[model samples]
Target: MVAPPDNDVLWARGLHHAHGGTSALAGVSVGVREGEILAVTGPRGSGKTTLLKCLSGQLVPSEGEVWFNSAPVHTLSSPSRERLRLDRFGWIDTEPHLVPELTAWENAALPLLLRGTGTRSAKHTAVEWLDRLDVGMCANRRPARLDQSQRQRIAIARALATTPQVLFADEPTAPLHRSDGTQVLRTLTTAARSHQITVVLATHDPEVATLADRSLALLDGRQSGAAAEAAGSSDEESRAACSLSV
Candidate 1:
């Protein structure tokens, strides 16, 4: 399937975030396009995660604007934002927040069930995603009983189960070893492209950065001129050279 136009997903212009004396992101502008995986990479406290939050509408930007499908997200009402978050966005944090007592399937089904889908249908959908992620064997296992990699897979299944239009993942492969991390990243990008979901991942891993269609680096809460230019450049040579090296 053809990817959606760049304007169809999230767009940020001159976005900034600050608290006390620190800046998270300064004058950051980027676009997340459907079927494209955008990676945000930076050092600790560089505002990678903060940028993700602003784009996902978890945190309002201190300056500039964030547009979701051409609509300014910050201008939307609370209920409208919540509705959009529930139906259109999927977020996966660094730590998988599965319930200790609930089985993997149950954890994956929670969102669908909360949306009023029948229990049977929710479980069915959850199992399908679990299977797709090659974790169906853990369907009945609780988070406490699963390994870190297993937990990560469950998190991925949950994120994709809803088939959201936008997927925001923060350090999705942070806990895994190199090989496992690559596998997980591949899984996420493959699923997203197949479903035409726009993906934005905040990570410090070089492998993750290399896999992204575009990469942006945040330094001391600001994007370097070189990085910003790379992010804005359309030329293939420039894009490959623009990726964050470290």
Candidate 2:
């Protein structure tokens, strides 16, 4: 694969968003490196989902810029942006949102099928991801047959089946128990690292943030104090002093 011109595969600058005149994001800027996991963390309404949507083109920002590789996402036509998302990006929302009637593997294959992969090949890839996520036995079950955690794993499998260039996960484990969440996250991060997939993870969990190569904290849609900055600093003292301990 050809190397990108810069380390950051995704970039956003001075992002601002408002829904019904209430600001969700305000002047948020961030850069995510290629093949690295970045955690976006905060309390509810901190604009975690909004930031992810804007960066991934799910929601166009009211103002600011988002760039994918060398392409300006904000300036692209709607169709172009849609194609970009379908072809190069993957998204895992807090909810699984699986098709109730579709089997697990079928639901996982949705992206591949949408992208025109042959049925057999799509199923193969989907099953592989589900197996990797430890949901192999659930592959034939429809959403209604499985519990919330199982459904979420299927959703994760669907996102990974495409081997997308970038993966955006917003509170992916919010629906599971601590043990289940830990296992699922371990599986997700391992698979992502093995594939060298860049990840933008949004969560309020400190344990989850420690899994990332770097993290950013948001408060009321804007980046907060220098805590995250200090964590990533090259200074030995800062590294030694980081509270996350990872």
**Which residue ranges in model 2 land beyond 4 Å of their true spot?**
1-5, 226-246
TM-score, each model? 0.87, 0.90
**Backbone clash tally for model 1?**
0
Per-residue alpha-carbon lDDT of candidate 1 for residues 46-147, written as tens digits (9 for 90 to 100): 888889888888888888888887678866777878888898899998889888989999999888987899999999999999988789999998999999
| Deviating ranges (above 4 Å) for candidate 1 | 1-8, 225-246
Of the candidates shown, which would achieve the greatest lDDT relative to the real structure?
2
lDDT of 2: 0.86
How accurate locally, in lDDT, is each candidate?
0.81, 0.86
lDDT of 1 at 154: 95
Candidate 1 vs. true structure, TM-score: 0.87
